[model samples]
Target: MSGEWQHGLLGCFDNFTLCLISWLVPCYQFGKNAEAVGESCLICGLGFLVPVVDIFLAIHIRGKIRESKGIQGSLIGDLLYWCFCPLCSLVQEAQEVGGAPQAISMGRE
Candidate 1:
């Protein structure tokens, strides 16, 4: 695993399906991300209902992902992503954990 986000915030458009999923159902994306990093998806899904706590939990989940995957990042960076561009962050997380686009496609075969 790389020590960084697989895609930049603005690069979400590169994966339209993931971008749309993140945009239309952010909580679902968050839950998926949580599951990928060995966290409790149910707790994350429930946390999304609370505004402030959700942001913190999202950051925590991102941190855990980074730690588990050896992704290099700082709290400030996590805060910025979680606060200003959560959908992009979620899409990036999905891409990283789910493997490359080709790898994901191959799995369905």
Candidate 2:
């Protein structure tokens, strides 16, 4: 029983990081407007961390949701692979693309 509790705790933590990375990546990539971006981050955080899966929540954001279901609530997220796998894939791609054996030569600054 205690072991199960610990596992659950760890799973929640994993989801938290998933939310953070997923929320931040697109925000940084798109350079959205400040107000909307801030609001979106807060909203996504709530859904991701809580494990509530943020079903069709129309009232909280006070706007019609572009899409309601969260990461785990969706097909991919339900597969237990939030975004870390993609991040790992990106790193793998980088390593493949002349990123391996990278040597940094320091020059006089």
Candidate 3:
């Protein structure tokens, strides 16, 4: 039940609306992504306001997604993605989870 990410990290153009939304309201988008993984949307969303907390949250969520999907990745890679291309990572996770409640339900055991 595990595999690679359905959406590539740089394939932002594949979902233009998602990319735009993630860019415009990152906290909201991050919240959505976190919620998809059964995390607290409000807390994770607000974590963006903190300087380093955001990175930690991003890394943790990315790990969750990778574990759920059986995608191959590392902590350093996740950190780099959050540091260099956070919006992309957000969109990537959102896309990976399909941004729908059903998406996570189907992804879990």
The residue ranges of model 2 lying beyond 4 angstroms of the native Cα positions read 1-39, 52-80, 83-109
Candidate achieving the largest TM-score? 3
Winner on TM-score (2 vs 3): 3
How much is 14 displaced in model 1, in angstroms? 2.2
How close to the true structure is residue 55 of candidate 2, measured as C-alpha lDDT?
27
lDDT of 3 at 53: 95
Candidate 1: tens digits of C-alpha lDDT, residues 1-109: 7666767767887777877777888787788788888888888978977989998987898888888888898888899988888777888887777722332454544
lDDT of 3: 0.86
TM-score (all chains, Cα) for each model = 0.82, 0.21, 0.86
* Candidate RMSDs in order: 3.6, 14.0, 6.3
Query: What local lDDT does model 2 show for residue 48?
Result: 36
- Residues 1-109 of candidate 3: C-alpha lDDT, one tens digit per residue: 5567888889887878888888889999889888888999999999977899999999999999898888998999999998999888888899998873232355546
Deviation (Å) of 66 in candidate 1: 1.0
Return the lDDT, model 2, position 87. Answer: 34
Candidates 1 and 2, the one with greater lDDT = 1
Supply every candidate's count of residue pairs whose N, Cα or C atoms clash at under 3 angstroms: 0, 0, 0
